[model samples]
Target: MSPSLEKILSEIEQLTPEEQLTVMGHLVERVKKHITQVQPKRKWSDLKSMAPYPLLGEDAQEWVSRTRKFADEHREGLQREE
Candidate 1:
């Protein structure tokens, strides 16, 4: 262990059981706060490289048109049912 960590442990050891518990709780809260403040770093290039398939050109346009048509038909069917 690092000297700083060893020193902290020694200081913790010097406390009474109740005081140690309080110190432990405070440390846990501090660690939780620190973890929450940390954010994962990502790049757009990295994300794009990981895509299963590229989205470009005629296929994407056709897909969007087909989806809109399907949604319109489904909504009309639901209205008829009501």
Candidate 2:
């Protein structure tokens, strides 16, 4: 950890329970504000047309099944040779 953060953490440890809770609340609010400013809300529509229909000229499920079948057959063949 950085020296500044380590010092701050040591100071926070000395604080009473109520003071710690107050500090935690302020930190949470600060983090929320930073996050909102850094990342804008996204909509599902943003992904529309990101990929053409069937995505690479092959149906998604068909591609997955084809790859899995190929992998399984290759594995079984390897096992038989063992």
By lDDT, the best candidate is 2
Q: Would you list the clashing residue pairs of candidate 1?
A: none
Q: Any runs in candidate 2 off by more than 4 Å, and if so which?
A: 37-82
> For residues 1-82, what per-residue lDDT tens digits would candidate 2 score against the true structure?
9999999999999999999999999999999997777667899999999998989899999999999999999999999999
lDDT of 2: 0.96
Candidate-wise lDDT, in order: 0.87, 0.96
RMSD (Å) per prediction:
5.6, 7.8
Q: 1-82, model 1: which lDDT tens digit per residue?
A: 9999999999999999999999989999999997788677977777765644445534777898999999999999999999
Candidate 2 shows a clash count of: 0
Q: 1 in model 2: Cα distance from truth in Å?
A: 0.5
At residue 69, candidate 2 shows an lDDT of: 100
| Candidate 1 residue runs with Cα over 4 Å from true position | 1-17, 26-40, 54-58
Best candidate, TM-score: 1
| Stretch of 10 with least lDDT, candidate 1 | 49-58
